[model samples]
Target: MSILESLELALKNIVSSKTRTVLTMLGIIIGVAAVIVIVGLGNGLEQYVTDSFSDMGTNTLTVTVMSRGSTRTLSVDEMYEIVDENSQYLDLCSPTVTMPGYVKIGSETITSTSVQGVSEDYFSISGDTVASGRGLQYSDMAARGKVCVIGAYLNLAYYGGNAVGQTLRVGGQSLTIVGVLAQTDEDLEEGGSDDCIYLPYTTASRLIGDVSSYIITMQSEDYIDESVAVLESALYEVFASDDYYTVTSMSEMLETMTSMINILVGVLAGIAAISLVVGGIGIMNIMLVSVTERTREIGIRKSLGAKERYIMQQFVIEAACTSALGGIIGILLGDGLSIAASTVVTRLMEETLTVAPTLSAVALAFGISVGIGILFGYLPAKKAAGLNPIDALHYD
Candidate 1:
């Protein structure tokens, strides 16, 4: 028989045993679906984390005291020490002392706001565009000015666009709204929107009553390794020891996170891989039953001069058909679940995440399913083909 004829007959036999065929296919369908969902979710989470860092600006580097340095003492002078030495490689740097307090303007008062003291470079350091008011300037810090920049969240919260150029008291110190940073951050987790409210470092230091301790933001233009090296070398020279300061870079953090997620995705998919094996086993069992039931058919075909190879080929095709159908269904369902999962994860993170089914992934799943069917089904089919035709025909 031709390959086409063998294929047509194989499918007919499968349909004739509809319940058994479907039950055998269940394992493949579940395995494929699980693999797709697990892998897609892993890839999506990596993308979400990377995008959140990108949203913070790829060139950005945040500086802070390390957790291990918790017992160590640091001063504002040390912040200047890191910058004064590293200033050549750095595009810009600014120090911040966060003080969360209430803001009051006339009859309006809003609490839970994160108040910060930064300088002229902080706005551009963060790519925050002024939608309504102006950001702090050199003279603002020099003259010990109380001028401030507010994010749109605070603008809409305590006052409307009406807050522009209006005076608000933070911690009982008066500040004039000079500029408003663009409200590009989409997070709504309580004070997440209130990412910053800029006052001159001088003003903030005095208001917070602690100029010595703070967060510093920096910008770097080179590769992550180079940037970290340059920043560390300069900071070490400034501190004369590693005991007092810590540095964290966006590229470094994002790269580490991406690698970790990839490994996790692989491990998760590997666990799901056991299901593929189980599905392949199901296919083999069903194929063996098919061969037994069709013993007479096999003998009649052999008597009619059909080759053993042809008979084996027919059973293999039946195995592949079951897997192919399951694979198609699984891809559809898995893609939908992955999209929803990524969406929810991104929302929880306050950042936009991209999750799309990749062509490589689709091809891999389909290819593997079909390959499993063939590999497992081949053994049973070979036994059926080598059957003693005379006995098959004479029996039952």
Candidate 2:
């Protein structure tokens, strides 16, 4: 018989002991499944992080004014200098000033709505557009614009509905609400909506006692690195001290998330490796027992003139075939389980399960598991091959 045919016969013999074969395969099954699931989770975390950052929107950066003595060390002039120097370096720029107040209209009053004074270009930088009413115009901000933009939460809170074209009090000063912001969850979570109110920069300065707080945001598309460097240089020249006020690059969030993903992958791989080793040991134990049981058969074949090398090859092939079969099934099971788990997680959280184990992961896991089986199975095969025909055949 051809060597392959002999191996196939050995596999058939193994299959005759169906329960034993299945029990043996179980180790490989568990090992492969663990690898796939852990690897899949690692991939999932990476995608989830990326999605969160993308939702934050395009090349965005924030500059904040930090001051020790509350006499307003950083003025609007500094904001102008930063913006003017770096406007070409970015897509959009804005300054943010915040105040806390109640919005009062006749008998209706909404408390704890955040009020913000932002440049007219804040909407463009934030990728937000008004759902209704007009946003802050350049003309409006220049006149210390009393005109304002309202977020959806404001509509729900003060107006009990749409408050477009309605008048609200800022520091008890009447200001016309010119626009309502679009209802995007991200926008609301951000300072623009459910959490806060928005007003033109000039009007906010008028309402709050002339304190311009922070140089907030700039946006860009390409060459973000170059833009960040230039902006940093310009801001340094303006502030001259890192402690005075700081500019934070949006890329920090991305970098942190990516680092977290790499760490997770490493941790998962380590955990999965333990399971694989356990599986390998199980295979070895089973093969050793099989060799012991087949000792008499090895002696009988040897007595009939089978060479030691042939006997060794036969047993080794048997062990390898057993492992290869187990690896195949285990791999399929692992991948299937990973996909199912991902689906369930998505349904429960209402978030996409964005990571999938690449084909390389499956191939590598299965191949390694099979290789381990052969490696571990070698000792038992060797013991069977070295059996003395006389003693082995004479055994009961």
Candidate 3:
């Protein structure tokens, strides 16, 4: 018989026993859906991580100095000098001083605001743009000016979006807001990315303590390794030991996070694929039962000069058709679940992460399902083909 005739026969058989066919395909359906959803979640997570790292400037490096009881210390000026000397690799440098205290804006005392002391170049390095007024300048840092820049949340919440020239108190020190940053996040809520304060490192040092952490940007991310090496060598010379100082690259961290996500997705997908095997076995079992039930038909066809190959072909086609149908249903179900998952995650986590299954994943899932059907169907098909016509004819 032709392949099309075999397929038609397979469909008729599947339709005639709808409940049994569905039961046999259940494993394939569940396995395909599970793998697709897991992979989609992984993709969304990786994108989220990449975006977060990008906001922090993936080309930048964060350095922390411990000094470790050593008398030698690196000053902000020395650090700038090192960057200036290695101008080819390093671009901008900023001393970061994290201040601890509640911010008092008028009568309101906000405890969630992040107040930091940074240089004029800090805004450039961090990719933060000033939306109103002017940013911190070299003159402000030189004279330890009390001027500061505010994020969008603080600007709109307290100053009604006119934060420039307004004053807020941090640790009892009044700082005039010189600029308002452009909104970085979609929603401006309290304690979010848009709620922040930035002042000159010199003024912050005077109020708090000396700066021990610095953020430096590379001229190009392509030369990250070289930039890190140069910066590390300079820091090593200052501390006289690697233990006294540490440098961390944001790009490297991003890569590590992506790799971890891929590995996790792979493992979860592999585990979910086990169901496909179970489903294949189910199909094989059902096909064997089918062959037994149709023994009289097989015997009559064989007695009428039907070939063994034709008998085997019909059974194999039936199994493949069943699996292919299940795979199509699984693809539809997986897509629906992915969309639902995206919405649920967004509402629960308060973040917009899209769960999108790739075309390759769907195609691969379908291919594997069909392949499994053929593989498992072969033994049953062989047994049916090898049945003795005389015995089958008289048995039932």
Candidate 4:
């Protein structure tokens, strides 16, 4: 028979036994859906990490100094001099001094607020803007002024949005709020990104020991490796050893996070693919039973001069069609689940993470399902083709 005629026959058989066909394809459906969902979740997580890194400035590098009993410590002026010398590679430098203390506003004492010492250039490097009043000035650092900038959370929650020129005590020292930063987060809550404070590094160092950390921005992100090498080399010369200081680039950290996510997704997808094999086995077993049930039909066709190749072609096509149908259903189910997962995650975690499945993943899954069907269907088709016409004809 022609291929089209055989395909028509295959469809009729599949339709006549609806329940059995669905049961056989269940494995393929579940496997494809599981793989797609897992891959989509991985994609969302990677995107979230990349976005978080981008907000923190990927062209920036963080340098931490650890005192290894060496009296030769790198001073803030020396650090600035290094950046000034390498003006082509480095653009901005700011010494970060974290002050440990609770913020006191009137009778309310808030310990959740983070107080840090930075420079006038720190706002530009961190992409923070002054919503009211003015940001830290160079004079503030020069004279060790006690002026500070407050985040939106403090401005709205404590000062009722007019925080500039307000007085707040940090580490028992009274500091005037010179500026209120523009809100970065959608919802301003306590201990969030919007709840923080910034002052001059000079003032903070006097209160909280010496400055041990610095944030430096590069002139160009395209030359991150060259810039990092120059910075590390300069720090090495200052301490005379690499053991006293460490330089880390945000771009390098982002790449490492993405690579780790990819590896995790690959392992999970591999595990979910095992179900496809189980589904294939189910198809094979069902096809073998089908061949036995249609023995009379096979015998009559063989007796009428039907070829063995034609019998094999019909059975193979039937299996492939069944698998293809299952794959289509699986793709639809996976897409629905992905959307639901995105919504549920967003509501529960309070973050917008979309679970989006890629087109390539869907296509590959469909192809694999069809391939499995053909592979498993071969043995049953072969057995049906090899049946003796005389014996099949006499058998009940």
Candidate 5:
């Protein structure tokens, strides 16, 4: 029989056994939909993190001392020396020291307040603007000034009315609020930019003791390579080993994150693929039952001069159609679910997340389902084809 005739016969068989066909297709539907949703979410998370870091600017570099290495303390003087030596390549340098403490205003005390001791250049490097009053200045650090800058959350949470110039006891030290940072959508968690307090590094060091790291802001992206080289040389002289210090640029970090995201996506997709395997086994099992039920029909067709290849083709085509139909429906449902999930996440984060399904993912999912149909349908198709017509007819 021709391929068209086989397909027509297969369609008739499928229509006659609608309930069984639907049950067999269920597995394919679930498997394809799962693959699409998993891939969509993985890609969306990667894009979200990439955009977040990209917005922070590529010209910035952070220098940190490794925790395991030598315990030699790095000082404010050493930090300035490195900055001054590479002043031609660098625009600003800020040393930061963070401590866990509480901010007390009479009876109202916010516990575990994030207090960052930073230099005058911190504001410019951080890309945040002062909402009121003035940012820290050279004089403040030089004088070990008893002044502080509160984030947007702190200003609104406790000191909404005339926050600047108000005295708040921080870590048992009386410090005047010199500035209140502008409200920002970024940093939505505790210890984030919008929830922390800033003070001059000198004063913070005096109160909190010791600075751990420094953030170097480059003049432009053009100077990153040269500045990094100069900074690394300086740090090498101080620490004497690559293990003692780490100088990393934002661009490098972005690359690392991209690699990690790709690996994670691959791993997640692999896990979802397991369902497709199970779905294929279901198709095979159903096709075997189908072959047995139609055994007498097969015998009559063969006795009337039907070829084994034609008999096998009809069954194979029928199984493929069932799986392909399921795949199409799964793709549509998966796409809808992916969009809904993205919308919910975007609202909760107050930021846009791209979770749109890619063309490649749709094609891949559909293709896998169809491939499973062909592979699993073959064994039963062959089994029915190999049966002896006389024996099949006599089996009742």
Candidate 6:
């Protein structure tokens, strides 16, 4: 018989035995759905992390001095020298010093207010804009001026729009607010930019007593690795010990995070594969029972000159069709569930989480389902083909 004829015959048999077909397909359906959901969720999590890191910009690099007891620490001047020497790759650099202070407005006292002292390019490199008045200038750092820039939240909460030119006490010293930063989404959260006040790094060092770290914003993302290597060499020349200073780029860190996420997704997908194995076992079990139940039909076909290969082909195709159909339904259901899961996570996390089922994942799940049917159906099909016609005919 032609393959098409065998396929048609298999379809007819499945329709006639609807209950058995559904029971046999149950395992494949659940398995494919589970795999798709697991993989879809993994992809969504990876995307979320990527988006978060992207917000920080990949061209940014941070350098920190590690203090191991007697180990030498990098000075602010050394940090500048490093940037100045590598001016070809670096667009801007800043030494930062941060401390916590109190902001008092009459009887209202907002404690734990962050005070950061940085260079003039701090705002430009950090992607912040000055909303009103003006940002810190070279003169501010040169003279260690007592002027400060305040975040949007600080201005709105305490100064009530009259923040600029107002004197605010930080660490018992009065600082005139020179600028109010543009409102940023990050400002709404605790410890975000909106809750901080900025000062010139020189002035901030005097307040905080030390500047141990610096950030170099790269002019181009393409040279991040080369830039990091150059910076490392320069730091070695300055500090003379690798343990004293560490250099890292946001792009490199992001790449590592992406690799970890991909590994996690693969692991999760493997765990979900257990369900497919179980479904395959179920298919084998059902096919075996089906072979026994159809012994009479097998005998009649054999007596009418049907070949063993034809008998086997029909049964295998039937099993494959059952699994393939189930897999199709499972893909649809899995897509719906994955979308629903994304919605639930978004609501819980207060962030938009997108779950998109990839075509590769869908194809893999469906292909596995069909392949399982063929592999598991083989033994039962061979058994039916090998059965003696006389014995099968004699059996009730």
> CA lDDT of each candidate?
0.75, 0.74, 0.93, 0.93, 0.84, 0.84
Summarize candidate 6's per-residue lDDT along 1-396 as a digit string, tens digits. 999998998889878988877887877888888889888887888788888777777788988876546556667777777778888888788888876667665566677568888999898888889999999999999999999999888888777877888878777777899999998773265556578888898888887777777878987898987889888998787667787878888888888988887898788778777777787888888889888999999999999999999999988998888889889988988999998998998889878777777999999999999999899888989999998999998889
Task: Please tell me which predicted candidate would have the highest TM-score against the true structure.
Answer: 4
lDDT (Cα, tens digit) per residue for candidate 4, span 123-182: 999999999999999999999999999999999999999888889999988999999999
TM-score of each: 0.86, 0.83, 0.95, 0.97, 0.86, 0.92
- Comparing 1 and 3 on lDDT, the stronger one: 3
Give the Å error, residue 112, model 2: 8.2
What candidate 6 gets wrong by more than 4 Å, as runs, is: 66-73, 101-106, 111-114, 186-193
lDDT (C-alpha) at residue 53 in model 6: 75
How many clashes in candidate 6?
0
List model 3 lDDT by residue over 1-396, tens digit each: 899999999999999999999999999999999989999999999999999999898999999987555478888899999999999999999999999989999998999999999999999998899999999999999999999999999999898889898899998999999999999898999899899999999999999877899999999999999999998999888777898788999999999999999999999999999999999999999999999999999999999998999999999999999998988888999999999999999999999899998999999999999999999899999999999999989967
- Candidate 4 stretches greater than 4 Å from native: none
Clashing pairs in 3: none
Native-vs-model 5 lDDT?
Answer: 0.84
- Residues 1-396 of candidate 1 have per-residue lDDT tens digits of 787887788788778888887788888878887888888777778777877778677776676654334344456566566666666555566777777678776766766677877768777766678887566778887898978888777777666656788778888888888877677755433476554477888887787665543333444456555656776676566556777566777677888999999999889888887788899999999889878888898888888888889888988888888878777777887788777877886788655565665778878988898999989889888988898889889857
Superposition error at 52 for model 1 (Å): 1.3
The regions of model 2 sitting more than 4 angstroms off are 1-3, 68-73, 98-115, 153-161, 167-175, 185-196, 202-222
Per-prediction backbone clash count:
4, 2, 0, 0, 0, 0
lDDT of 2 by residue, 11-130 (tens): 887889888888877777787778777788778878887777776654677666655575536666666766666767665556677776676768767666778888887887677778
Pairs that collide in candidate 1 are: 133-179, 133-180, 134-178, 134-179
